[model samples]
Target: MPSTVPDSLDGWWCDSSTEYAFVGFSYEVTACQSRSTLNSEFKDIRETFDGRYVRLYGACDRTGFYDDVIDAAWNNGLGVHALIWFGFEGGSEWKDRRDNLIDTLWNNPKAKFVTRAVQFGSEPLYDYVLDPSDLAGNIWEFKWNIEDLGIPVTISELAYGYQVRGGAQIVLDSIDVLDAHILPYFSQTASTGDAAWKDVNNDLNWFIDHAAGRKIWFSQNGWPSTHYSGVEPNSPDAVADVDNEERYYKLLESKCEFFKSVAGGGVGWFWHIYADWQEPGYGLYAESGKTKFDFKPRTEC
Candidate 1:
């Protein structure tokens, strides 16, 4: 539990933890990439990163999207935790959208077979459109509705939403596991990647102390590589930069055992993204195929 990070930036952390980390990433289900490219992407994840699953963020309503991505995962021997993204602050439309996806899944055999879980929403409570209790009620509703298909239901929010936000505990029975998002950069409490890892560990420990009966999964978690102009994160006291992102990757490898320990508030995390896109650019691989850091996760960790 002491600092695994090197004392100076001149050295990198060595990962000796023997525990196999059940890693994952959020991959874009885009038609822009050729079928071979898609296949290669999933192949790299399973072989290169030892990934067990992938998180699909959007396009759940489309039948084609499911057909495409699920097949890719299946071919690569990976399962998927598909998402129903209601990326909004307020809306009654999400209810209809949720039902539409259920309808989509109910009809599709591949989706039913390859899908491990269906996350109802991303940060609905954190966005404040729905209160914690109301959000929990929605998740409960979704859980039972998808029961016949045998897919577990959950919601993605900050861990604080489950712990501090009111009435979130009421929905525990309805969910298979808690898919909370953890971003210490956004928390603004830590100044460096080492501190951020400690912050994350402390947060997970808090979950162990408080939410003792629940299995927590950080379905969305990562540090940004850069802002708009290739500078540091837009904060005076923050460390959301390439250096910290690289540092975070090292720490992740070093603490693989701690992360995957099922009994110790362990979480299955999907690094928030595989590459940069529209905004808040948290890309491991950039637009021009440039890697922000040469993050070979398991190799020589």
Candidate 2:
């Protein structure tokens, strides 16, 4: 809720009341410390917004601080949906940390109002090599954990944007919901199977068909100011280059519309108003307080 959010997109879906309607923001939990810090950031977000719900996701990389961050967000009146297991995997303190975090969040009545996500691994299918057995077993384990914890679980992955067609069915059959992640930087690469936005749509449609009565969410999708290697920062030409930060913004806008079109299906953006995160040029708003995208939507909202 810092003073770095756009005025558009507020109440865009006020009249919507369908299963596919979705409009929410996402925030990394441990980006800052103290309840006030979180509150101020999100406060800045909601002040200009209305209607669209905010889905605060506890970034799982700092699994150790999940509870602390969740407690802060909740106390500040930030609605949290999808408690992401930021970097949790099959064997990483699987039982204790997972259970404890779920216990902490679910015990609260308000927390139950927020959608829950139990990410198995960060891009588990791509980052790690899990054959059918391993993949199915890990998914089943996470599913059981989700059911036991009494929350819906999603499998969040980056390449799912392209592979969601076949991959989605495989996952949907095994889990309760499929969470697909589409990063602008790597989304067009071969790993995604198809780089075209239309292809991503096709994959999403396929998911709808095969999801049975289950749900599907575009869990993570956003653009970076620059591409890998930090290239194209100062390119002279106007050609589309993944390394160009400006180009990333343009790509993100178009992608946002596409995701928005599927709002009823629960699509959540990856970042809220940005802040420096031990990296250069990633936050939606640079640490300098200059907003990166003039229209960076608020995930806190």
How well is each residue in 1-301 modelled by candidate 2, as lDDT tens digits? Answer: 3233223333322232232323444555545455566566656554543213344443444443555545544444454444434353355554455566566554644344333445554456555445544666766875665564455565666545325334544555676665666443443332211233554555567555555645556555444443435433232222332244444444444555455455344444444324545234445556677665455443321
Candidate No. with top lDDT: 1
Worst window of 10 by summed lDDT in candidate 2 = 12-21
**Please, what are the lDDT tens digits per residue for candidate 1 over residues 134-162?**
76788777877777776767776676666
Candidate 1 wrong stretches, greater than 4 Å:
1-22, 29-37, 58-63, 228-235, 262-265, 278-280, 299-301
TM-score of every model? Answer: 0.80, 0.64
Least accurate 10 contiguous residues by lDDT in model 1: 9-18
Error of 1 at 85 (Å): 1.1
Record all residue pairs in model 1 with backbone atoms less than 3 Å apart, i.e. clashing.
15-301
lDDT of each: 0.65, 0.47
